[model samples]
Target: MRTLRRRMGLLVVPVLGLGLVGCCGSGERGSDASAAAAGFERAISTGDTAAVCAALAPESLSEVEESGKAECADAIPESRLPVGGSVRTVDVYGRQARVVLASDTLFLSQFTDGWKVVAAGCRLRAGHPYQCAVKGG
Candidate 1:
């Protein structure tokens, strides 16, 4: 009986350790992505253009600057992205995320620093990707 119990303990310990390792990274990443999305929404509602610009991904900031011939901080508010309601849901996959608000949809990407907004004020189009007022492209 003692030998059988010891064998079971060996199997259980390794299984439990692997399970913990699998969950730890993913759980933290999901929460971090959601917080970044919520913070972006708050910046828009408060008319904090600088904060909004800071929340944008590098590619998105470049797109804004190139298209408007203005700095990202100056151009972000001028884009007039729809101010959606509170965040309803955040979905994360690998390095990408989608956040749904009451009146708008936002896409985000994970960077070395953290998550950043890649698109905002997006609407669905038949058989196409979302059409966004502010997008990385």
Candidate 2:
């Protein structure tokens, strides 16, 4: 009986350790997503084009810049930006994560930098998607 109890204890210790590790990892991911969302909100509020651009994905930046409709440095109006939203849910796989925000708009992509806004507008469109656009610096 003593030997059986000892063996169970050993198994329990490893299971508890693994559980702790999993919780820590999940917490870190949540913190990252929260920080990214907060940064985006703050940048938009302050009209910090640089901050906003920095948070964007590389391909997105290039596409917006090349389109010529708007530049990355443009200040986004308060109306166009999200006011309050929490990370409703976050799905992560490897270096990428997709976070669902509580705002009216929907942002896509699994970003290592958390959930950055890939696209936003009153309505999602195919060709002419509405996002923060700025002209020449």
lDDT of 2 by residue, 1-137 (tens): 01101131121112222223223325676567556756665676677878877766665566446654557675344225454455565543344333445663323344554565554332323443323332111
| Candidate 1 per-residue lDDT over residues 46-132, each given as its tens digit | 998889999999878887888778998887766788887877766565676667789987777799999998888877555444567
Clashes of 1: 0
For every model shown, what is its TM-score relative to the native structure?
0.76, 0.51
RMSD of 2: 16.1
Clashing pairs in 2: 71-134, 97-110
Candidate 2: regions farther than 4 A off? 1-25, 75-81, 104-137
TM-score of 1: 0.76
